[model samples]
Target: MEEANETIVAEFMLLGFSGVHDKLQMFLFFVLLLTYLVTLTGNLLIVFIVWVDHRLHTPMYFFISNLSFLEIWFTLVTNPKMLLNFLSDSKTISFLACMAQSYFYFTLGAAEFILLMVMSFDRYVAIYHSLQYAAIMKQRLCIQLGFVSWVGGFLIISSWMVLVYKLRFRGPNVINHFFCDSTPLFQLSCNDTQLIKRVDSILLSSIVLTSLCLTMISYASIFYSILRIPSATGRQKGFSTCASPLTVVVMAYGSCFVLYGRPTGYLSLEINKGVTLLNTVVYPFLNSFIYSLRNKSVKLALRVAFSHNKTKLFPKLCCAP
Candidate 1:
């Protein structure tokens, strides 16, 4: 009788976007699937080019490869559960599992954010001080920048992760959004989340404001130099190099601000999630397309590889022709 009264269980249902229209599910599934395939292909191609080609062994490409890997991991961190929720009527995740999910999501997201800023700085150095770009952005320095980004993200996000674990949840376990976003998670917790809210505000503000300022400063100088160039061709070349990185920065920072920096409210939850998904999908696709496809060296490498494969498959035809 005593055992019957006590609840014995772990894990809670995630009421994803299931309550919405039925057609929405099908639409979301197709959209997410398409995005996933493109993200995977684009990021993997970048990693392969960076690893196999000796000429791409530079600080810029090194950071680009790292960004590619991070984008794939970023998509995985959120998309699988989202895809699962879209298919399943009742989605569930354990308390510990949810906390772990939140941790990894924020950590990886923050790391990539910092890495983008570092890449901007790299471009600034290369453009303005081309003579000293090698000495300044050496392999050792690139490695250090990557390490710092990861560690900084971990240290900053760990506090909130701990806060999340400490909070109590007594009522509905259903998270409003698809994945365990920090804002939605805060809403679900029963305890007073004032401190967590303050901390989160500070952290998100620091990420957006500081990074935006730095990127803006770099671009301000970059654009100034481009304007001073007497030759139209020189100016166009400078602008073109800045275009890809600037596009990435705008997309990343804009989405980040929409998702995290804004005030948390019941109405905006779904919209926020959608914005995040857009950023994750768009950044990887655009980066790979813009930076790799347009690059002469990468195109040459791909062409060479394709020819080699073709030759191997038709060795007899080569002699006949």
Candidate 2:
């Protein structure tokens, strides 16, 4: 085989939402800015609540805290750059910077996939073997599982990024998407990317599809276990506990599989952009609300934290001194 020439391009112009009218771009700027802020605050609040509230120190909340932390960095990796691009006339990102963004973006995403699976297992153990749940999901085990998810995700993506870095980009440095994703970046490569494309498809499909399958299986077992419970209230409580995470799992995996599960040739930039928005932008913001608002423990924790802060801030007023 002939050698492919290396990329001469030093920078890439991220043509983010250039198709949108200026007014709409400005509208999107604020909307995305607000969304980012909310995503940060919400996910951070979950982390804080989990940290301070002893009631939430179970294996389930432990996994949630990890997910919330992942969302913080996950949203941070892309949104700030996308937000800046929306405001600026020059949407140029250095090739190295673009690659870095892509690396972290996929890394965090993979971590989330594994973390969600860990959470499903936590739920399964909690329901399936209630007596042994505590024994099985001890603090050391939970920490190890969480650590493996983060490390495994990074390792998986690191190998893929090495391939991405090797691909040559001769010219036309405009990426027609908000971020440097594998699909868009692969489209820009000048070399024979057939091998990389196949590798990417297989890796993404294996990680996402496998995790999704495991999650579904865990939920199935949990559901069966719930059915065996004679009390309606017990069943309702069981469903309530599982509902929020299940919703998140569905949303996260659904968007991801649609975007990354298939070959690059099959993807449309317009549709991909919309799906990216849902997966990256919308889901992070929604995750906190889904996990927190629906959770009684989280609600109570928030109220207690708020009251504690209020008392600290205005002790005399609160105490009627």
Candidate 3:
């Protein structure tokens, strides 16, 4: 109602971390740059390895490659802007760009969240019901699952994007966080966002809570099956297969629980900014590290690739004598 009479703000200012200590912003810039580099490199490597190695052509690796691609898109959508904000005193974002930024970030992130649950479910099926794993997660089924994730993410975030665009920004135009999160975007609007916030809460709870519960259930079954392996070594190997994904799910959902579960007015902008940045950057880096270091296939692939490249480059040297 109020938005009908109000005009949309031309631009929004990102308050960012400038309100904090004097030189800490510089520190954050480099730290975040390092994080971005690692996240990009790691996720890229996963995609590369999965693509190049024919051994990784299973349904599980298919989902992993999609997840890896999603992370790269996710980081690209948010981190570059945040990195730029660190150096620029004026962190101004156009109304359209802000909406676009928030949309892709929300969409990719939600998809990744759901994708992780799917991956966990895949693992559970494999560990708990080895015979049915392939039958259950067939190529067609994997395609459907991936499609559903992308569709669900886009539809949900797009609805919010429309809701956000309709609001009038007659109030303060400064977003307290590094990027255009829902809370800060709503905060700048002249409209009463009570209904919007409620709708957001319901959607978030369903997505975050339901997905987390499913992941937990999958893991519970996997753990139970692990225990029945009879031999200690077999049990340990089974658990080790899941350890990395479990750790990532915990960190990601843990951060979301804190950031999203808070009352809109009660949120600490600085903390929310830091958490978002860390979540996007940390998980990708860790996923890359975990998959590369722990998975023998990936390491072996890398070693082979490297040796082949070296061999090509040093052919003349080898025959010089």
Candidate 4:
């Protein structure tokens, strides 16, 4: 009977902020829709700017482009479905769909984690070894680092996905979050999940701790190098360059630590939902803004692109007989 019940559960209902009032839900729908559009536009613009501007063709821009690309898919995996659920009465996701969402969510998320660390290292190299920065961070090396971030992140989370796929959901099919996160899924599993929980703790701790430590070390070295410079201009320039990546790291790592740093049982669902919303929806928007505002190269690229487009359009309009 237990086995039959497990097999019978084929779909999971996502209870995404269902406790909110109707008016609040409607307001949230438009708000999230606007956020989605802005996130897409901002990240896509960064990608375009990095690709077309030869002057901005450095290792830093290359990594920024890759990070922008990752942010696009990262928000896509869950935000659209969440928007749909805001309007629909039935917020059910299939077993397969949930699994796919979870996989992509973790994949892009983990990739961003490593990518940010890589960006930190790039800064360290640029500041600490300015003379050899070009030689050290050649095109080949940049591409390889980006590739490793994506592939390594995927590999790290693949085991968790496998374990999740094997778990059986028998009775309660409701997930009390926006998307198919492992925490809620674990709660609904009929099988013993002690091993899965332990593995999750180990993996999350190892990855987050290692990445955080490396990022810290890179920044510490970077600051030490900056302080030793005699010129205030050089010190200011160093701080300015590191600002964007540092902001992103703080937001990304802070949210992650709050969400996954502790045992799942200790977290409140409401707090988790809010934190997840900030992490998934708000952070992408913030990331793009931070980079664009702080990085002069990206700002120049944007200005050049816009001016070139306007010039081309103006000539065509004015030439119309």
Question: What lDDT does the true structure give each of the candidates?
Answer: 0.80, 0.91, 0.83, 0.91
Error of 3 at 36 (Å): 0.5
Q: Which stretches of candidate 3 lie over 4 Å from their true place?
A: 1-7, 20-22, 318-321
Error of 2 at 114 (Å): 0.4
Candidate 3 residues 1-321, lDDT tens each? 244666557888987777867588788789889988988988898889888889888877888888888889988987898889888878998888998998898888788789889989889988998988878888899999989888888887777677777877865788887888888788677789888887788778878889999999999999999999999999999988898789879887987887887776566666677777678777677777877787887789888877777879998875677
Which tens-of-lDDT digit does each residue in 177-261 have in candidate 2?
9999888788788888888887787787778889989999999999999999999999999998899999999899889878876
Whole-model alpha-carbon lDDT for candidate 1: 0.80
Q: How many clashes in candidate 3?
A: 0
**Overall local distance difference test of candidate 3:** 0.83
What pairs collide in candidate 3?
Answer: none
List per-candidate RMSD values in Å.
2.7, 2.4, 2.4, 1.9
Give the per-residue lDDT digits (tens) of candidate 1, residues 200-298.
Answer: 888887876787888899989889888988999999999988888888888888778777665677337667766766776666667778767877777
List TM-score per model, in order: 0.91, 0.96, 0.93, 0.96
What's model 2's overall lDDT?
0.91
Error of 2 at 19 (Å): 1.0
Clash count for each candidate, listed in order shown: 0, 0, 0, 0
